[model samples]
Target: MRAYERLLKYVSYETTSDESSETCPSSPKELVLAEALVEELKQIGVADAHVDKDGYVYGSIPATKGAENEKAIGLIAHMDTAPAMSGANIKPRIIKDYDGADIVLNEKLGVVMDTVTFPHLTNYVGQDLIVTDGTTLLGADDKAGVAEIMTAAAQIIEADAQAGEGSAHGKICIAFTPDEEIGRGADRFDVEHFGADYAYTVDGGMLGEIEFENFNAASAKVHIKGENIHPGEAKNKMKNASLLAMEFNSMLPPAEIPAHTEGYEGFFHLCGMSGDEENAHLDYIVRDHSMDKFLERKAMLERITAYLNQKYGEGTVTLNMKDSYYNMREKLESDMYIVDRAVEAMRENDVEPIIQPIRGGTDGARLSFMGLPCPNLSTGGHNFHGKYEYVCIQSMDKMVDIIKTIVRKSN
Candidate 1:
């Protein structure tokens, strides 16, 4: 089956991960897709295909007789969709040969995807695009990756059956992870048991994109304490916590934010804020590609807290910070050949390699540090995690071929 066809079936299952949930898979619904994937793998001739207790689906295709000693290559993609948008009951429509004009996603909701707001629509003018309705995300973020990998596996098995001894290739390991959108995709991963020398995460955006560098991430929560007083009697004694929270945010560099930064630039994003007269809270996520700069950013948060405490009195502002993940480039630098292999595979499949740094983190970023020198590959998706999300059907088909080439050339 074509990758896009598989994607349509896969997205039918509601697999939106919950960050607030403390469970391993974050949501029990993810296991539904995980089990289905295992069944599909088994049907494709993988004897040991199964979903583990942690909701990770694993299966391996053994090497042909002559290629047994060659290096093992692994393909990885996540199963769960981001919790930022509704993943339930997604209504996807295909735009056959896009006309580079505004697309009315939902006439009733007055939702339109205009070329002026999303100029990248022109890039896929002559290509088929799978897009979401006005209500929900398309789930192409990694489902496209999942479908491409699964289709590649099916093609390899069919080729082996037809060729008898099969086209020369090494062992191919496949894994579909859960909760990647919430950043715990690799938390319980068993790298040693996966039995691959290296892996590639098919969780990136756009066609031909190969990412090895990602942000060094951290999360910060700031709390403010203030005394509430009646408005009529309030004077110099009243200290509003909500106003104090705004002051804390005003201390940050306005230009160094997600809206203003791009490429290699780092940012301090205020993800959420809540406040009242007595107490206030601010949640932020810090990101930088450079480790030194990442550390400096954390220190800057500490400095801000200290200065605020001095100005408002000690114990008034409380800051809590934690590191999320480091740049995978630090771990993959020594094993650069893995990245080169992907580049060659893309070129062999008639796709130009676009090596760029990921503005966001992927499961591969943490996996690389877990002794799996993994880089990231694109799923031919765009505008991930939102209703404007889409994927080029032509690009998804090409990605399947590219994945097949990557594994076959491993011999």
Candidate 2:
């Protein structure tokens, strides 16, 4: 089956991961897709295909005859959708030969995807686009990745069966992970058991893209406590925590935000905020490509916390900060050939490689640090993690061919 067809089947399972949940998979619903994937892998000739206790799926295809001694290559993709939008009951429709005009996603909800806001729509004018119905995200962030890997695996198996020893290639390993959106996709991963000298995560945006560098990530949570007083009797008595929380946000660089930053630039994003008269909270994520700059960003947050606490009471402001993942370029620098192979594979398929740094982290980032030397490959998707998300059919098919070329033996 085509990769997009498999994606339609995969998105029907409703695999939105929960950030608040402490479970391994983060949500029990992810296991439903995991189990189904295991079954599909086994049907495709991966005899040992199985889902682990933590909802990670693993399968492998043995190298043909003389190619048994060749190094193994792994393909990885996440199974769960992001929590930023709802993934339940996704109704996707295909726009065949897009006209480069505004798309009315939902007439009743008055939701329209305009070309002015998303000018990238012009890029897929002659191709088919699979989009959502304005109520939920399209789940193409990584499901499109999963489908590409599966379709490639199926084609490899079929070719090997027909050509026998003539179709020589290295061992191919496959894994589908859970909770990638919440940053725990590689927490319980068994990298040693995966048995790949190197891997490529088919979990990126746009076609012909190969990403080896990603953000050095950290999350910060700030809490403020204030003494409430009657407004009529208050002179300097009322210290509103809500106002203090706003002050803390104001201390951050106004220009250094997701909206203003691009390429190698760093940013402090305020993901969530809640406040009242006596108590308030701010949640933020800090990201930078440079390790030194990443440390400085964290230190800036610490300094702001200290200043707020000294100005208010000693126990007024409390800060909780933790590092998420570092840039994978540090780990993949020595094994840059893996990245070159992907670039060559894309060119072989007549697609020009776009080697760019990911603005966000992928499971491959953490996996590379864990001794796997993995880079990320595109899934032909655009506008991920929202209702306006889409994937190009021709791009998905091209990615499938590119993956096959990456695994197959050269002439």
Q: Write one digit per residue (lDDT tens) for candidate 2, span 47-105.
A: 98999999999999998878888779999999999999999999999999998889999
TM-scores for candidates 1 onward, in order: 0.92, 0.90
lDDT of 1 by residue, 1-411 (tens): 899999999989999999999998999999999999999999989888999999999999998768888889999999999999999999899999998999999999999999989888899999999999889998998899999999999999889878754377889999999999998999999999899998999988889999999999999999999889998898987889999999999989999999999999999999999999999999999999999999998998899999989988899899999888899999989779889999999998888999999888878989998889999999999899999999999999999999988888453
- Scored against the true structure, residue 58 in model 2 reaches a CA lDDT of 94
Identify the candidate with maximal TM-score: 1
In candidate 1, how many Å is residue 214 off? Answer: 1.1
lDDT of 1: 0.92
Cα-based lDDT for every prediction: 0.92, 0.93
Instruction: Give the runs in model 2 whose Cα sits over 4 Å from its true position.
Output: 164-166, 224-247, 273-280, 307-317
